[model samples]
Target chain A: MLVRFWGTRGSIPKAMRAEVVRSKVIAALVAADGRRFDSETAVARFVDEELEMPVAGTYGGATSCVEVDGGEGDFLVCDMGSGFREFGIDAARRMAEGHSKTFNIFMSHMHWDHIMGFPFFGPSFDPEVKIRFFGGHDDLEEALRRQQEEISFPVPFEWLKANIEFNKVVPGETVEVGGYQVSTVKQYHSHDSYGYRFEAGGKSLVYSTDSEHKDDDPESEDMFVEFFRDADLVIFDTMYSLLDAWTIKQDWGHSSNVVAVDLCSRAGAHRVAMFHHEPIHDDADIHRVHTETIRYEELIGRNSRLEVLCAYDGMEVAL
Target chain B: MELKQETRERALIVAPNGVIDHDSAPAFEEQLHKVLKSADDGALSLIIDMKDIEYMSTVGLRVLMRVSKRAREASVDIKVAGMNACMCEIFKISRFDKVMQVFDTVDAALAG
Candidate 1:
């Protein structure tokens, strides 16, 4: 299963964000000599100028969408955010191979960012495409319609002419979609959220976003943690930093990179792509967080058996 | 698949081991609840020895969770003994360390 980053930026759009594209960019420039973080200034330079990507600010297009398939034509996605625009285009291309393509999309919640790209999803806009939407909200259709409401946007819900289906799933229930065993659990957030796990092709992927961490109730905690155990990949919420998430954004309906890292480590996930980048973070800042999150994982001894990657726009994973 | 019980002083020792799994979780829980309820009536403490245990699935952990909740509700404390690393890892990952007390040896658990 090959994984690629389509839209890695978080929150908002950014240019010059791909400021420092990869560790090699920093390694070739700052740390070519293979030395550890020597001084505060050196670490600061690496943090600031190291992994910057080509984007403007945190608005590096906060399109959160990812597709997992092995080019065998099985498409499973997690969200319909602005990123879906690009995913839709690629999905259309895949449809070239076969007509009546099947698409399964799991929305974390009714949040705008998670479903903003619904109407524009290429296949959904196409008459030959079939799209199945899954989430834990009862009013799934109304929630989706809110995005295309005349007041919110020029286009109305009736404008989309694609074949679309929606299911209102409850947390802790399991359903099979597109040959994948799909199960969900309730996640803490402003609007109730769902953390879903899909097992197929002898691999598993868990999507947990917009979930706020709470230690007060054991049952809630167990429901969240036990729901995603031993996941092969977990795309999780990382909308804030630790300081902001706990002291300030506490109970604000999002998680920090620290929380995401902890979840990946504790759940023994093989890969963790941090999701829900804060809109305030510029391209450079988001890249910095991504790089620093790796360092922080090492310090916290949570890096074992977990590969950390930032999700990028237009990226595809051959799973 | 069944629960056996004994008593020493105020501590009532309960043992339920042997092929515990998700399928038998309900039985395990019921037996555990019966023992704890019996202890709550008079016994000062409850000790569960899982030495003969071979396996535990999610359902097994569910049983443990129910017992912990039961302990909290009745104020009848529980001590677990003879946990293997695999079981310990599951408990640790679930953050059960903060919720339930665990020990390495039955002697240590009993003494505590």
Candidate 2:
């Protein structure tokens, strides 16, 4: 299976400011010294080899849409954050290339950031397309419809041309969708969120975000460990530092990178992708946190090898 | 988890040796709770000396936080001292340092 990150930011959409862009450019120039590259390939090589990610590129600002490819029949997606607009456009082009017009969407929760891109999603306006939404919330359809009400958006939910179906998934029950066996686990969030585990062929993937793991909750920790056990890649919420998560940001429904590595390591998961980037963190801050999480894993990942990958927009990992 | 307790004129000091982790955090918590419950009216302060602690995880930190809250409700002062570098970093990163007073030595904690 292949997992693709279209948007990785959490809470809200964040765009890079001019000053931030200029700073990156200046940093790159300084790193390059006075050397002038003769070819595009050489410049690409320099950027790839010489400059770090924070200086060379960005960790994008689009909120939480991820696509799971390599499945049969239909397209599968997790969340529909602002990135879904772009995903929808691309899906349209893929359909022109003989791809299926069916979409299977898994919603973690209906917070504004998670569903904001739905209004701009191109496939929703296509009469021939079919969409299926699966989530743990009973009000999944209600939340989507409320967002599209006349006062909030230009288009009404009833006017959407696609045939959309909402299916409520109960925790601990396995359901087959798009040829993958999927299970949901309740998560701790404001209105509650759900984490998903998808198994296909011999590989497994877990999508767990917007969840807080309190220090006092051993039962919750064990439940999450079991949910994440032996997965190929687990997309986790790493939006806060250990200091922030347990202190000022306690009970805020987001977790830290330290907790992510600790939990994933205990589960024996092969790898983890730090998802839901904190909106306030710039590329450098994210990189620093990512580096710290790796070091933390090395410190506590006893008897296990866990690869930590920081999620970025348009990143793809094949398992 | 082995906890050694000493009673001073105005304080009860509990020192835990070995690692405080998932397996031992419960016992560590229970022992601290026991000390708090049995303290005389004269023993108004609680000192946790971490001189011998090898390591601590999130669970152990939680125990300390819970104990601190309990101590506060009982109108007892709580202080931590003698943490090694690793333990200090853990405390700092989790901001447990901000939750309660921390000292370099037990003597300094007692003096304060």
Candidate 3:
């Protein structure tokens, strides 16, 4: 499995906000256990060694694109943000070089930040590539269609040459696409949003992109506990500060790292990728968030054998 | 885990108002099956007062789905009402929603 992050900024994209310039915070990643980079010195070394150009979060960037392929391999990327444009180029180059045929793009919601990168996704331009898009909204087709609405697009949805399969499933319904077992639960957002749990090649990965965790309520807590149960990896939407989550952005659809780290440990997830970085946050803020998140996670009692990580553009994890 | 049958006309409304777990699942299933059989006199409907049931399990689903299947086969009506969200997800998972017509009130079930 190869998980890569092309973008990490949350809310809307900001370019000049110092946070955007020094954007060393990586709230997204690609997952494949090619190697482990856990220590700060190790990460610094990798950023200095592996990446030709160290990329960080930029406003109007992509969230995360994970390409998992082994037994029943998959090219499923979550959120079609600006980062997806780069991933799309990668996939397109792979396709040009004869990489894979079918690609499944799963969207957490149709929010602008999550959808802005679609027009730039290069695979959609390829005649031979197929894109299977999945999401939970009242009308999945309309959401996809609206993306190509001519008010903004030069071509219509019908004019697309590439086959884009839209799968709209009800909550609790499980769908097996190719060899991947995709289980979904309606997550907490103001309107309808979906959180996906993917099980493939004996590995379980849960993507909770945009969710709000109000652990004060027992029902909400139980619902989360039930949804996560036991899992290996969790990509969570930790887009707000604890102060913002509890105060300013009270009902906004995102979690704080406190909620993210705590929920990951509680749900027995082995690792967590803290994603959907707030646009105002820079690299130092990320380090601080990590410290604060670990503090809150410790307050929940230390039974959790969990790994927490920050993501940035072009970061990859092999598991 | 006791058999508490409350009769409504010829219809037998088995109101097993508690959490149906392993400790109580068999008794609940058996007793409900009996009530369903006795209500086979072609009553208009067989109602399960799920109003008081705080929780229902996969084992409990065995009872509901069986009764629903039998009632459908016998040409007698079977319906459940007043389920909370927790129990509703159980039905949604088993896809019991499409098979059984659920309502919020007994009158609505009887009327349907």
Top candidate (TM-score): 2
Candidate lDDT values, in order: 0.69, 0.91, 0.68
**Which 10 consecutive residues of model 3 chain A have the lowest summed lDDT?**
A24-33
Worst 10 residues of 2 chain A by lDDT: A293-302
Task: Encode model 1's per-residue lDDT on A1-319: one tens digit a residue.
Answer: 4454445444444444344345436545553356677798876676567534432213246466666664464577877777777777877876886733778778777667777777777676667667778888878789888888888888787877777888777666789877778898887887788888878778888777778875335466555556657787778788776545544467888776766766567667777877777766655566877876776565444237567777665444444
Worst 10 residues of 1 chain A by lDDT: A51-60
RMSD (CA, Å), each prediction: 10.4, 2.3, 15.8
Q: Model 3 over residues B39-104: C-alpha lDDT tens digits?
A: 776464678878778876444765676667778888877778778766665554334576678887
Rank list by DockQ: 2, 1, 3
Index of the highest-DockQ prediction: 2
| lDDT for each residue of candidate 3 in A93-141, tens digit (9 for 90 to 100) | 6766666768887777877677877777766766787888888776666
- Distance from true position, residue A299, model 1, in Å? 2.6
Of 2 and 3, which scores higher on lDDT?
2
Shift of residue B112 alpha carbon in model 1, Å: 43
* Candidate 1 positional error at A231, Å: 1.1
lDDT of 2 by residue, A1-319 (tens): 9999999999999999999999999999999999999999999999999899999998999999999997457999999999999999999999988899999999999999999999999989889999999999999999999999999998999999999999999999999998999999999999999999999989999999999998778899999999999999999999987767876888999998888988999899999999999999999989988887777676666698999999999999999
Tell me how candidate 1 scores on lDDT.
0.69
Which ranges of candidate 1 are over 4 A from the true structure? Answer: A1-5, A8-60, A316-319, B1-112
